[model samples]
Target: MTKFKKRPSKLKKFLGLLGPGLVTGASDDDPSGIATYSQAGAQFGLATLWLALLTFPLMAAIQGMCARIGLVTSQGLTVTLKNHYSKPLLYIMLLFSFPAITLNIGADIQGMGAVAHMIIPAIPVSVFCVAFTAILMFIIIKYPYQKIAKILKWLCLSLLLYMIVPFMIKQDWVLVVKNTFIPTIHFNKEFFSIVVAILGTTISPYLFFWQATMEVENMAQSKRKIIVNKRVLGDMRTDVNTGMVLSNLVMFFIILTTGSVLYNSGIRQIDTVDQAAKALEPLTGKLTYLIFAIGVLGTGLLAIPVLAGSQSYMLAETFGWEAGLDKKFPQAKAFYISIIISLLVGLSLDFLGISPIKALLFTAITYGLTAPILIAIILHIGNNKEIMGENTNSKFSNVLGFITLFIMTVAAVALIYFLFK
Candidate 1:
């Protein structure tokens, strides 16, 4: 008789549960996101910390819907949209998302190159930009999906530096707790813009595409047929929840650290990730600054692929060309070329001499406007019985998804109104 197999350790099991959700969540805090959060903290202090708490549940639900759509339909969101929605509508989405993602990629690459220059002043920012562009394009084209995903999961550990930063500085735990749980709103244009930027950076449209496509990628990687199983759905929920919580937790602490340190010190503007890191040196010393810089680099490496991959996935799906990171270069020529073109275009943006902070701010605003449209479309697909079949969103998911859509729409309108006012 065969002996009973020993059970896997709890930690190992939990680690196994993480995948698309974890990567998606971590990628949400890319360089652009860091800059936006830093701007929020430097300008409004802890007054905006409450948005972090508010967004976690909403982010989880929206991403969960995306993951379910992919898992159930066994197709990327774009493919599903192509099959079920009007061509004009699909093209409309592509028009909005493509440029926004490209701009984000450019801003993210710029941020990474800026931080690299700060670490090694001898190298020019253009060099770092070109190097990063080449490296990421190579990784996407050459690496297997599983290998790239594992590397991204490990890179997420770098974000822990933000959490540790607040402990190194003097923090008002009393006020931090109060502001985190209590909602605060400022009606001015700057505050409104920052709020929109924060929301945009947090619940981004690219993550929606990435989440759904990666879930499809996972299915294909597992060699599983397109079938819905209860165990798979449960695992997806756990992964999405854990990932969103981690993303928002980092956002909260980053805001807290900057608010306690830079805002308190009367440093009210962060024009770049380098400036933000440098501003923290006097309060938390060089070590913290170094870690912050490294975090920017690591997250950028993790995020640029997702941004480029999302665009490629949409284009390939729409045009009926083969697409998947797991495929060989020759097997998915159009897909790989799209990724290469996006990276190169973004690299060109770096040489244009746009200020990193200004570029990032503009990227955030673009995401803010585009995200709601995508969210509304996602909600429609998730609720469509033909597309999602029995895997359609439950009441809980629908409520949170609609709430997120509503909030984002209002924020978008508010941003424009305040700008004109």
Candidate 2:
């Protein structure tokens, strides 16, 4: 007699739906992003909270297109770009991406180090940075893709602390709700710069690369030669949507918590995660500070790997070296080396005497400058029939993609104007 196969339970199935999208989304809230969002909250109050809502659809569309590209083509974005675009253009894009990603990694490692030092005063920040770099490199080199993804997914739970913190403090629900739904525009230079930073950090370039490659990784894990089935596509949509929602929800709460506590308490500037945490102690108690610190550390762990990995993947693909987190160190020496170099360079930034929060903000500004160029390329690829085939972006996707591009372009132009003026 033939035996019946056991079906997965609802919870099991729901968990199964998550993959690269979830991990990518979680990584989006990295230390730098936390710094940017926290700065926005502390500096501007609830005026910027609506950005979390506004960016959700735009981010989902762009990332969904990226996921579709990987699933359909069975390649990372860099490989696809190399195949279609000129060698000169590819090199130029890589040149822009490398430094931006490097600065981001450096800032993130520095942020993590600062937080580590905050938690343990006796240990120096340099030691923590070195330790974090070593620990993350070991995990990426030793763990298989599935295990790494699982660990990252669990780390995302730390962001729930942001959601919980908001409820612990009294809030002006009327003002919060009003500001969240209604857009608030400030013509000031500082506001414009922060808006650009918020947009840049949220819909980041690293995430673009990570999301696409991750879909490719997931396809490999499934042992599928091609992604042609409607069911498979549907599952991907579910995963991407779920991940983006969770990412933005965490962003929303972070802004809300800081706006209610830090901004209201007259702490208008947040130079470190420590300052943000300490300012919360009097208002939300010690637990709030602990949770914020943990959230920053957790997100840093989740994000630094992605930052390093995205660079490795793009470089490996561009240079025709074997790449994938699934491969052993011996099998993918270049890829592994790329990761090590990124982490070490980032770790060194901690000793540069630059303020962690300032470095983090500067990285966001760099991303803001580079992200639009990458987004434009993504849109072009998503709409190219030869590249995406029937999976080409729908009208709705195209509309949202262009809107996102336009918004970023305007922000960039506005930023330049403010700088010159």
Candidate 3:
């Protein structure tokens, strides 16, 4: 008998819908972001929960535009900029992006190492840091795009562990609900700095590059002639929005966890993910701490590849070198070499005596300063009829993108002002 193809189950369809956006979104809540959110909650209690509501739409809009840019252009953001924009702008992005992404990788590696040390006092943090660097390097070189993408998708589940932590302890549901809906503002340098950190960390520049490049890579690997059409864009939008929502939900639960467990007990000032995990052990016991620590490590594995890969992709595109996760090391030697160098440099930060907390804060500031400019460029690229053709930014997207630009501009200024003030 002639057989009909078995239809994919809804679960499989949903999973299929998830790709670059989901991984990018989940990676956004990397170890450094965890530190930022944990600090906000520990220091200010539930005051910042409402910010999650505000950022979700903004992040989705920007990431969606980026994915669209990649889809319509069939090229990474860097290539588009290189072809259309000025060389000065492209080089400047590279300069800031390299350090910003490298520092981010360093901080994540350190955070994961410290958390591992906490779990096993016998292992030295430096050793763990080096070991992680080696393992990550091997995986990037060993795996092609599909394998790496699959691994990243699976690692996204580690974020759910944070969701579990809040339920493990008794929480004031009413207080959490009140804080979720109510916006709280404290007018001070410290408060505004944390606000900027959250903004900068969530609406990051590297993820924009990574998202677009990933879409291009995804398309390149497919055997089918991927056309950029309404249905395709719709799927892309679904993926990006789903990722943004997942990322912010993890942020919400993390804030809730630290706000309830640490803030209520009179502890505050969580500067690092390891510190946040350590702080939880005494109060919420070892299990919650273990979950949080493991999540940190998982986020590092998910995020570092993104951090390093985006940096390398930026360089690859800028220099016209071969690139893509799909290319084997021999096929993309420079690409893999850059990844190795980034990981090594990041690992060296710990051994070089640079503090991870400072690295993370600097990384945030770097991103804060650079993000607004990149957003403006993305807006222009998205709207340029020659570049995007029929896939230009919609009115709603333009509105959200402009709002994000305005907010990020104000936040960037505030972050700098606070630094000098």
Candidate 4:
């Protein structure tokens, strides 16, 4: 009994250190995320699972830089950009990012309503969209930031559902194992398209804004001022590495679960969480369906606030108004108002009768377009000694970061050409 108690106590302490990274990483698998993963599995089978491995280090480096920015400056990305870069550049970047983030929040709320439609079919998605947006607003506007973060942290545990189901489905261990290591590129339009989408989704632009701001939130939680040093850099690295690794692992399982269950059975489309859940039933069993549903609900709860908060942060920072969930609503009226506006905008999109699946994919494509520029800014900021002090990026991290930026930029260009042409 003493041994058991001691181990559980140790686990709790470990988890305490893991809060921000886990919540951010897990939220990466929101309904939009699930849709992306499901589409990859349904369309291409396990071919793209290999890309998750490639993006892990790149994602970690970028996120680690974002965390360090906050720890060093105690300010969010938009604020820092305004101070560090020219105003015209800042506004131009925001022009791309703000609309993308706002649309994404709308898409996420719409996805949540779509999921709710699964649980109660008669209830219209638009009504649930409004209700869900209102509930998230109350939570953010009415509650403490720390409490919201904690709730998201716990809600994040729903990710394990996909992890558990993949194993239970009993896949071709040899093939799954083979695909994990071997990289295959078909080099055709569709293959390149999927590859681009994977990069876009994994290394998203909004995530850059969200991560940097959350770092400020984390610093606020620690009640620490901006103190630049190597130690803070080290801590930021650990936080990001832990988060990115967990995120990629979850990505792996999402692909594996869908590939094993859906692709193997010739199901080529997954439009909603409900479709994915039903598709998982025959291959992975009903228990897995329940697990998938639970994961959806949990991710929805965890991600909606993040979606809203990123938009709020951008809007607040761009205008020079007081912001941060840590500040009381009255103290940060612009911040809270931005959140409400984003919520309403998102809810209205759903009410307009746009298909949730289409909204998610379109939003994802928008992220694809906007992500590379954000990545460039992040890498540039990370290398700045004034901002990072002695905590500037290592040579190795810089090398990988540049490679990621280059690849993503090229992909973004190609995606735009292909889409419009």
Tell me how far the alpha carbon of residue 52 in candidate 4 is from the true structure, in angstroms, after superposition.
Answer: 1.4
Higher-scoring candidate on lDDT, 3 or 4: 3
Candidate 1: regions farther than 4 A off: none
C-alpha lDDT of all candidate models, in order: 0.90, 0.87, 0.93, 0.78
Residue-level lDDT of model 2, residues 274-382, one tens digit each, is 6788788888898888889899899999988999999999999999999999999999999999999988887777777766666676777777888788889999999
TM for every model, in the order presented, reads: 0.98, 0.97, 0.98, 0.92
Question: Which model is ahead, 1 or 2, in terms of lDDT?
Answer: 1
Q: Which ranges in model 3 have alpha carbons more than 4 Å from their true place?
A: none
RMSD of each: 1.2, 1.4, 1.1, 3.2
Backbone clashes, candidate 4: 0
Candidate 4 C-alpha lDDT tens digits along 1-421: 4554444576565565675666777778787778778878887789888878988988887877777777777788889999988999888877776665666677677667766776688998778877877788888988888988888877867876677777676778889878889987775665666677677667877777888888878877775465657665665666678778877887898888888778888998887667887787777776887787777777877887887788778878888889888788899998898888877877787667767666666666677777777778888898899887776778998898898888787877776666666
Q: Rank the candidates by TM-score, best first.
A: 3, 1, 2, 4
lDDT of 3 at 388: 96
Question: What TM-score would candidate 2 get against the native?
Answer: 0.97
